[model samples]
Target: MNSLFLAFIGVGMMAAGFALYSRFLGSKVYRLSAKYATPAHTMEDGVDFVPTNKYVLWGHHFTSVAGAAPIIGPAVAVIWGWVPAFLWVTLGTVFFAGMHDLGVLWASLRHRGQSIGTLSGRYIGARGRNLFLVIIFLLLLMVNTAFATVISKLLVSTPTAVIPTWGAIVVALLIGQAIYRFKWNLPAVSVVGVVSLYTLMVVGDRFPIVLPETVMGIPDRGVWIILLFTYAFAASLLPVWVLLQPRDYINGLQLFVGLIILYGSVLITHPDVVAPTFNDNVPEGTPGIFPLLFVTIACGAVSGFHGVVASGTSSKQLDKETDARFVGYFGAVGEGLLSLGTIIATTAGFKTLANWEEVYNEWSAGGVNAFISGGGSIINEGLGIPTSLSATILATMAILFAATTMDSGVRLQRMVVEEIGQIMGLKISALVATIIAVGVAFALTFSSGADGSGGMLIWPLFGTTNQLMAGLSMAIIAVILTHLRRPAWPVLIPLCFVVTVAMWAALLQLGTLWAGRNWLLLGIDVVIIIAAIWVVVESASAIMRARKAPAVAWSDADTDAPAPHHVG
Candidate 1:
């Protein structure tokens, strides 16, 4: 198929999924009415109660939802054929993703906009909340490390992508500052930001940043890990308005513009997907089907990580209950759109290339593994960029995307872990707290991307784990919607299905990797397997407990209704 045609089909499906699934049915399930929902939920001097606008809320919600997992998962899953990658992204978004996201926001609405973690305490009971926190804290840790590995590879490989990415961010920050502080018109500032991003791209193409010789002294992989850690630390300590939020908004804009450029380029060129979406035989070492494909293509379908975003950080900043459904469900649709774009780019110039297997193997050199890991580089050559430069550009894109997510993940993990630590009477100081958070992040980053596998197997684990989390979240939402006794089936059916599939996938992975007994793989498998089982058990218990609770009349208080009671 022509890459252009595929792009159109995939995008159309994504749009249709949002319209048919989320706008009409999901909106009903997650109902976001402004009047009944509290904004500040009793404002506090610091933390949890900060009032934020929908735009900035977009930054928090989107960056949370958008991460390294999407790019990596689809790239590897394409090993099974684009059919699974494209279908999972499209269908999953409509039925399952929309429900999970909207449900998360809906549950938060009941506790005066409290986070899912907090609501678990009040609604599900103390033990469920504790169990939820343990999963969440560690999930954030894995996320931080995974993204760190992604970025380090990108920085080392793609010298040119830096200037444009960082420049777009600086431009975004200045514009954000001008708008929020100086009271500039948002539309005008946004336009400037767009223009600046393009200019940065042009210059980045002309003169991308290269790593210094000293930095390059270390092995190509080792240098990347060190640089990534240093970058993560700097990013964590900075203020959100300056780099965090603005960069996110810009990233969203970049997502929009880059996708358009991709679609347009394909339309003009009419490039064929030269290689079949899936390879015929598995690579020498990798498995050919089923379990691996399910693990590899995790983000396209469902992710455990999204749950953390939905209930943990984004919930804290929601201004109205209704907005949560829009942000949560729709944001995922947008991310689906992103994965589709990467697929198109990989397939775009395939017609001219020979020896697809050789090209696909080269992708592992850098972060190109995330976008074109199993695919040939026919598209890269067709773009008129040298193979090396094309690879660098791809690497830069992944690294920047990973950097944005890692910064946010570390901060979130810090918040949750610190909260837990304080409750445990650990007496951690502010500086010590910073170390604890960064310490965990560093531990995860140390040997990441080391296997020359370029972060493929790990991605499925990320996806499965993330999906498990989302499933647990869906369970919470299912229990809540059923308790409310408003039209529940629309969301609940998908809810049950996604959790089952995701849990099945995660458990399968943990076991497979454990049997493989690659120690690093084993460690990840163990952590995630335990977490998934806990979530599945918690979700099942939540459902049973809620079902068995004494019946309440229609429109009973959301809080007074029984919470999912599974706990530590």
Candidate 2:
């Protein structure tokens, strides 16, 4: 089949899902109300809570959640077959992730922008809240470590990407300063920021920035990893407007531009699907597609992490309740599109089936390289650009995506850690909490694994945990729906599906880790399974309690007021 046809089908499905299905979800299922003053206005603090434009907020939310995981996950999962990866990205985004993201954002908005972790307490209990926070902390830690490792590895492998990657950061800092400090026009600054970053990409392609073999006696990758985490630590410590928000805004534009190039390339090149739809050349000990594919493609299809971002930062800045549909639902659709691009590039960009097989043979490393190569090939063919420069640009984009995630992940981790500290009655400063969070992530990144896989070694755990978090977020939203006497099926159905798939995948991973005697990962898997069960039980109990209690009337004032139970 023509890859362009497949790509169009996927993109068309997402567009229809956004226009029709998501609209139904917003109007019927979620019933978002503009009458209710959002926390951004009601709880405007100017630091964490501030009213914002929907378009700008959507950019922040989308880029923050659309990390390298979506790319890496689909890139890896296509090894099983493009069919499973493509189907899951298409269906999961519309049905599962969209609902989950929208529901959580709505629930958070209705609860004064409290995070999903804090909402668990109101809906489930204080114990569930603690459990939720712990799970979130660990999940964010994995995210930080994995992204740091991935970005460092990319920089080390593709030296040309190094300059553009760091150059973008510098550009982001300048953009942030210019917009906030000088009161520069955002659109103007954004265009300049995007142009500056891409110019750096072109220059870096010609004069690549290669690091020495050893930096302070550490391997180049290790040095890059350490340096990346150090940068993450500093980025986490900075205020959102100065760095996090503006940087994501710029990176979001980069992503938007990159996607246009990729999709246009696909349409122009009209490549055939060279990769097999279903391949039995499975790697030894890899889990089957049944549950693994769902977990593997978490970000594109339906990520629990999106729920985190929605409730964590996006909800706080939501200017109107009505914008949740645009910010939350469409953010998910954007991620699905990225995932679809990944599927198409990985499947069709290969020159020959044999070449594709050779790349897929070593699942982890090959998957990453194949996506870059294939994506670069398509862009080159479409734009008449040189393959090497196009590949470098794509690699630079990947590095930026990963870096953005790491930047956000470490910052989120700091918040989670501080929340945990607050729960424990510890008065740790943000700097201390951030240092602790970065320390743990750094340790985990350097930990031993086969062939020094580092974060890759525990990617399965990360994927399962991410999906489980999504399931848990859905469970919280379901409880909220039950309390409000609203239809709970929208949230409950996705919750059940994610929990089941995540649990199944987790068990398979536990066995794999045990057989390999990877005690650390084995223990982490066991704890994750236990945590999943606890969340399920807590959600069920919340539902039962809601059934017994009388339905509460919806009031805008009540939603805008701070909940007594909000610890974060």
Candidate 3:
């Protein structure tokens, strides 16, 4: 099969899903209305709740939720075969991720932009809310720790990316100052920001910066990890407009350009699909593809972490309720396109089946490195760009993505920590909360000494834990819809599917952990499974209670103020 044709089919499916299906969702299901003033207006603080342009907000939302998972997950999962990974990315993005992301955004908007974890108490119960917080905290911790390791390793391996990767922070700070302080035109600022970012990439490619093996007695990777968390701590403390918003916005634009380069390479080169559609010969010890495939490819398809990002940060910055469709749904489509590109690069970018097999000899072999090398090759062959520059560009893309996500994840974790403090009858300041969040992440990263390899220890649980988080988020949305007496099957159906699959995957992981005598992970996995099951029970009960209660009449009137118990 021709890679170009497969790529087009995947892109076409996502396009139709956004164009036709998202419309049905916006009007008929979510019933989004511009009249609904989002928290950005109602609670307009200079810090976290300032009204934002939809495009800029979409950039922030898209890149923050993207992280490196979409690239890493699909790039690795193609080991099963391109057919399954491609189908799941397209279909899951359309029916599962689009609705999940958009729904969480809408739910948060209608409730004063409270996070899904906080909203759980109002709809589900105090107990459910507490458990939801646990899931969210764990997920954020995993993201921060794991991504630090990913970024650190990339920095060590691809020294050329170092300058651009860190230089992007300066570009974003300037973009923020230009837009918010100088009041420059947004389009002009955006063009300058993107061009500045790319220029840094080129300069970095020409002059690489390799750190010594030991930087003041710390290994290079460990030093990078410490520096990354330190930056994240500061970035999380700054106001959104100062760093978070602009950094994510520019990174999002740069990422789209990178995607176009990748997708365009496929169309221009018309490479052959060298890997099999379905691999009958499986690597020993590789788990069955059924449930694992769904969890492995969570980000590009459907992810609970997206819910955390949607409700936690994005909703607070949303200027209008209607922008949720674009920022939330279309943002999901953007990631699906990236994931689709990964599938193509890994499966078809290689020259032959034997070459592809060499890279996929083991279950864990194909990851971000595979995507960088393979996709870099395609770009070099198709566009006549040098491989070194292409690799630098892609490496910078991955680094920027991970860094932005780390920014938001740390911020969100800080918010969660503050929430937990409130529950404990203690007041936690933002600075204090941020210190705790970053402190925990840093401790985990260096737990196995300064090498900073400990962060990946619990990463194996991220897939199941993340997918389950998505299901639990859907549970919150479904409960809210039932209370409002509106249609909920759109959320409910996917809710059921995701929860079932994730729970199954968690059980499978439990056995694997137990067999390996990995007691720590096994214990944590047990807690997550139990918390998820308990939340589902609470949500089911909440839905039943809502069905029996008086139904609030749905309305699109401008006067529909968000009420604690109802929205009519």
What are the per-residue Cα lDDT tens digits for candidate 2 across 1-568? 7898888799899889889988988887778888898888888876678787687788788888887888888999998888888889999988888888888899889888888998897778888888888789878877877777778778878888878888887888898789767988888998999899889888888888777887667778888887888888888877676777787888888888998999999888889998888978766755577887888889998888888888888899898899999999898998898888888889888888888887877646455677899999889988888898888878887888778777778877877888888888998888899889988877777776321247665666888899999999998877767766787787787788889989998998888888899998898889878878997898898788777877756776575534322123
Task: Tell me the lDDT of model 1 at 368.
Answer: 50
* Candidate ranking (lDDT, best to worst): 3, 2, 1
Q: What's the TM-score of each model vs. the native?
A: 0.85, 0.95, 0.98
* Candidate 1, run of 10 with poorest lDDT: 552-561
Query: In what order do the candidates fall by TM-score, top score first?
Result: 3, 2, 1
| TM-score, prediction 1 | 0.85
Give the poorly placed runs of model 3, Cα more than 4 Å off: 554-568
**What lDDT does each candidate get?**
0.61, 0.82, 0.91
The model with the greatest TM-score is 3
Model 3: per-residue lDDT, tens digit, 1-568? 9999988899999999999988988998888998877788888898999899999999999999999999999988888888999999999999999999999999888878889998898888789999999989999999999999999999999999999999999999999999899999999999999999999999999999998999888999999999999999998889899999999999999999999999889889989999889988767777899899999999999999999999889999998889999999999999999899989989988999999998999886899999998999999999988999999999999989989999999999999999999999999999999999999999998999888998887899999999999999999889878877778999999999999999999999999999999999999999999999999999998888888878755454433334435322
